[model samples]
Target: MDGDVENAPLTDEQVSDQWKRLADLINKLQARTDTKDEFNARPGSSLTGDDAWSPPFHVSHAVNACIVAGADHLHACKTLVVDAHSLHVAAPASLIRGSLENMAAAFWMLHPTSRAERVTRCLRWQMVNAKNARRALAPLDLKDPASYDERIATILEVAQRHPEIDIAAVKRGFTSTAAVTYADEHSGAALGVLLPWQLCSGFAHGFTWANLAFSERVEIPTADPDVFSVRFSTDLTRALYLVWAATNLTESVLKLHAQRSTPQY
Candidate 1:
């Protein structure tokens, strides 16, 4: 059974269908309105307690951007391939790893009961991005904080305004791996998400353990040289599992955003 299973072809219609579903999810991003979301006009929707501010839109924008970024990474993973695609092992996994992170971050940012909690998560996510941007700005004025520093400072001030959140307790940077694990646990996916995500991370980063685990290998043991010659090939089953996990995670993000963005009325 094991030999036959190993030799069996990896052709399946389900993987193709999942890709189509992901494409559909990406299309929904366009339907969302930028100017008019009815969030501000709706009563009792003011989580910030200021009629001028729209927490839903402010928070959703970053979260949705994550979805869009994830879509780009996933789209780069073209199903169509020609010629020698042997180097495909690391590429798709790398792309899916990105997709997983985006989906997880979006889910984590929006997956809170209180609007303050959601806003705090968004602030943290943006704080990390701002700090990264500040680093990229070379020769940053050390004597006086630059605009990026001011931006982060403003975010910290905002974080302190909410009584529900403790700024001192929160970390400066968001952890994508923990977010991915949390998202997968709540995603209701048939297959495990964190394992696939970690496997992808490992494979994408050129980790030796992932190399043997993800690829098909035929080895020749040499006693004289105390060495072994090995050949590695693509493992389609594992590839399909990655696709399955991405599909579920992306779908969950889209669904959650749709539900959260729409007004109760």
Candidate 2:
């Protein structure tokens, strides 16, 4: 993951600056076209229509780019092959929805029939490419020829062994929802993240620091009081909204991450 971007020949500081600029752009863009009730309304209820909804994907892609670029910068700066490929970079705040939409649009532009599937596919590929870029930029302790295969193997191992995530349990513990939608698109590899529920429910509050990397999507369909709907896509680099949550689920995610981080090794 770290190696892909590292080999780009860009300086660490330059890469970092790029990420910062990208992040800022995404933030401002989000602010300009805020997600309104209309946007969040039922699928057919988008008053702004299809064209207006495209911005989210753009924001998502830019943020993912930052992660990819940022990972490269990290590798270049630290010479460490971090597992940037895993479920740690798909946060709402980090992923630009507009990017996802744009990627999908471009993909379908080539093979129109596969448009729906292409959306997720392109996103997943972008994620892998970003990871590759990071891996490329990764620096090693010894100035010897770096083995791409070896680094990929390490990343795969890290992804496979990453701590398990339980979205259902966590959401239930934190929110007061009776039921939530658990939409999952298994067509492609989707990156999952835990979000701060308050951001969605809070008036004027927007995005929050998302727990970008999570193994999969688990919903609390049976939770009482608050209804939780968990939407997931195959695009590992794409962002999925809590869509709906009665309370802040950020604490639950934090606890989950903390518990998993506890070393048995």
Please, what is the whole-model Cα lDDT of each candidate in the order they appear? 0.65, 0.28
Local accuracy of candidate 2 as per-residue lDDT tens digits, 29-79: 334234342112122321112212223332123323333332232222121
> What TM-score would every model get versus the actual structure?
0.77, 0.19
Which regions of candidate 2 deviate over 4 angstroms?
A: 1-8, 35-103, 106-265
Measured by TM-score, the strongest candidate is 1
Tell me the tens digit of each residue's lDDT in model 1 across 55-152.
Answer: 43367567767877777666555442211333377787898899889988988877776776777777778778877787876355653446777777
Q: How far is candidate 2 from the true structure (C-alpha RMSD, Å)?
A: 25.1
Q: Return the top candidate by lDDT.
A: 1
Question: Which ranges in model 1 have alpha carbons more than 4 Å from their true place?
Answer: 1-57, 79-87, 139-145, 169-171, 221-225
